[model samples]
Target: MIAQQAIGLIAISALASACAPELYKRDGIHPAHIQKRQHIPNVVEDTRGWTFDQSEEWNTQSPGWGACFAGTQQSPIDLQTSWGFAKSSPPVFNYPKALKGPLNNWDFGPQFTLAAVADDNTTEASIQFSHDGVEETAYFRSWHTHAPAEHTIDGYAPRAELHYVHYDDAGIPRAVVGFFVDQATAENPSSGSAFYKQLESLALPDIFNNQTIPEITLDLNLAISEVNDYKNFWTYKGSLTTPPCLEGLRWFVSKDIIYLSDAQLESLLKVSTFGARPVHRVWGHQVNA
Candidate 1:
C-alpha cells in the first residue's frame, strides 16, 4: 500500500512542475524594518546575509539559492494524518529547571540561548530518540517563531508556529520539534496558558530592537507537561524553509495547537515579520506519527 502511494505521489509531483512558476511574496519583510540586527548584547543573527524582500530575485545573490526552489524535500509542506505510519518512538526532552538567556536571533527568531559564553562547548539541553532503528541524541540550540505559522495540517493554517531546534553534541543541526499557535477565542480558550507565562515574560520588543537585554528564563518542562496529551506529532524528512534550503533534516510537527490570549498573541506578532517561505512539495517522503 505504501509503495503504491509513493508511486502515485511521484506521478503527481512530476506533473506539478509543468505548471507556471507560482510566486508568493513576503509581506512587510524588510531588513530596515528592524535596523541593525545583532547590534546589541545576546542578540544574534548573521551580520552579513540576504533579506526576504531584498531585490526580489534572491538567486541573484547566490546561485546556490536555487536549491531553495529546486530541492525535492523542501519543508513547510502541508501534512496529513494519512501520509505516515506510527513513529517508532517519541523524542525525549532534557530541559533544565532554568535555561538561560532569550538571545535575540533576528534571523531565525529568538533563541533561548543556554550557552553562557561564545567559547562554551557543552551540551545545555537535549532530545533523545530512535528513528529507523538508529538511536540519536540532539541538543537544544534555539527556539524560533514565525507569523501565520509554517506547515499546515490537512490544509488548516494556524495563527503562528514555534520551532525547538536541536543539534548533535558538536552543534550540528539535528532535529526540530514544531508546534502550531492558535488564538484564544471566547469559545475556545488556551490550553497551554501555564507555559505561555514564559512567553509573557518575554513580551518585550527590546528583544528585537537591539536595546537593553533583559533577564529572561524558560520553563520548558512545564510546557511539556501541559502539552503531554498533545504529544502526538507527525515526523518527516525535510529541509529548512529559508534560502539555500538544506535537506536531510528530521522534522516533528505537533498534532495540537498552542493557544494564546489576544494580548499574548499580539505580543508575538509585534516582534514577528512575514518572511515565511511558501509551502513546498512533500514528494515521496513518508510522514510518521
Candidate 2:
C-alpha cells in the first residue's frame, strides 16, 4: 500500500507538472494571494552555499536577501531579559501531547522541513495564542532549525534553535515560536522533546538534496513542553531572519531553555553544520525576555 501510494504521488506530481505549470509553480507551490516572494530568488538547487554562515555575503553574493542587510525590523534578536513589560496574561499553545503514528519528514538539503503534505493543505500544523491586544490563531505551515540558535538570551546564544513557522489564514507569516536548546548536563541529559529526537534521527544521514521520510511518529506535545513555559517568554515584531528579510512577522522567543544531549547536538551539526545566520543588530525594537 505504501509503495502504491508513493508511486501514485509521483505519477500525480509528474502529471501536474506536465499538464499545467501555471496551476502550480515549477517549485511545487500553488499560487495564491501570497505575499510578494518574486523578489526572492530560487533556492531549490542553491542550498549548499546559501546558508546562515554566508548570510553576511547575501547582499553581494546572495542577492536574494539584500534586504536582510537593509531591513530594520529583523529577527533573531538578542532577548534582553531586563526589558519589556511583564504582563499577567501569557500566551498558550493548543498542541497535541502525543502524535498517533508516523508523520512525513522532508530533507530540503540545508535543513529538515516538515508539513502536512498528505492532506494537500497549505498548513501542516497550527496553534493558538493571545497576548497583549493580539488575539490570533497561527497555522503551522512549515518548520526549520538554526544551529547555535538565532535569538540570544541576555547575550548568550543556545546550542540550537527550533523555529516553528506559523501563518495566518491570509497566507501571511503571523508568528514564529523559537525554542532555544542548550547542552544538557550529566544530571539532566534528556529534555523529553521527542520531536527533536525524531528530527535528529531523520536528518543524521546528511543527504544534501530533496528527500522524504514517509512515516515517523512523534509526541507533538512533548516537543512543545520541551520549550513552552506559559510564564517565561519574549514576544516582539520581527522579520523572517532569512532571505528577503520580510518584516511584519510576530516572534515568540521562549524564555525556558530546553536541554539537548551531546549525541543529539552532534546529529544536528552533522546534518547542517553552517545553517545559522549571524546575529543582526536590533535597535529600537520591543522585546520582553
Candidate 3:
C-alpha cells in the first residue's frame, strides 16, 4: 500500500509539470499575472471590447484581470514639460546600420503584431540604447503601430505613434521610442518613409487574407532613419499602455516628428484599434531631453 501511494504521487507530480504554462522573463522579474503567451496575446481574448478602452473587462473591474487598475503607474499620459524636469542629457540610441529578420505578421484581432520569426538566425535583429545615468543597454524586441497615436506630445497628438518596445538582458522593459508621425499634406507628401510603407504593405494584404502571415523581411534601419531627429525627445516612467498596464517602463517621446502618407495612414487605421487607453489625468511626469 505504501509503494502504491508513492507511485500515485509521482504520477500526479509529472502530470502537473507537464501542464505548466511556459514562462517568460521580463525586466529580470516575472509576475504570476504576466506571461508572454503567444509572444504577445493576439488581442484581449476575454469578453472585453476589442480595444484597450474596454475597461469593463479589465483587471480593475473584473478583479485579477491583470494590473490594469490595481497598479498606479498607468501609461498613455500627456507628455508635457510641466510634469517632470528636463534632463540636460538623455539616453542615446545605438541602432544598427541594418536590422535582419524573418519577421512574422500576425493578424492580431485588433492590431497587427509584427514579430521576429523566433529562430536562431532570425533572432539576431536588435538595437541598443544607453543614457549616461543608466549602465545597461536596452535591446529592441518588436515594434507596432497605433492610429491617432497614444501618448500626446506637448498637447499635440500626431496621426500615429510607432512604439519600439525594447527590453534588457534580464527581460525588463528598458525603453520605448515613440516616433510620432504626422500626415503629409498634398503640398509635402512624406512618401519617403520605408518603414511606414512596409507596415502598409503588411496591413493591406491582411485586409484581404484575414490571416497571419509569416516569413517576411523589413529593413529596420531604414525605417528608424526616416525620423529626422531622434535626440530631441522626452523621457518618463510609465506603464505599458496596453492591458495589464505594467509599470516601470522607460518612455521616450521624440520631438522630431515624421510624416506618413495619407494612403499609409488609411491602411493602418483599417488594421489597428482606434488608439489606446485615454491620456491619463495624472500629470507631472515628463523629462525633456
RMSD of model 1, in Å?
A: 10.5
Worst 10 residues of 2 by lDDT: 17-26
lDDT of 1: 0.61
Give the candidates in order of lDDT, highest first: 1, 2, 3
- The predictions' CA RMSDs to the true structure, in order, are 10.5, 10.4, 8.7
Off by over 4 Å in 2: 1-49, 61-66, 84-88, 97-124, 186-194, 199-210
Cα TM-score per model: 0.75, 0.70, 0.68
Highest TM-score: give the candidate number. 1
lDDT of each: 0.61, 0.55, 0.53
- Model 1 Cα lDDT, one tens digit per residue, 1-289: 9999998986544332211111111234356644433332223222235555452355565565565666777778898867663445568778897886644534334445455446432456888876566888887765667777889878878888877766665434567778888898777776446666776755454334543234577776765665554357788887766644656668888776777878777777776676455676677445772
Candidate 1 displacement at residue 266 in angstroms: 1.5
Q: 34, model 1: CA deviation in Å?
A: 12
Which ranges of candidate 3 are over 4 A from the true structure? Answer: 1-50, 61-67, 81-90, 97-132, 186-189, 199-210, 283-286
Pairs clashing within candidate 2:
103-216, 116-124, 125-140
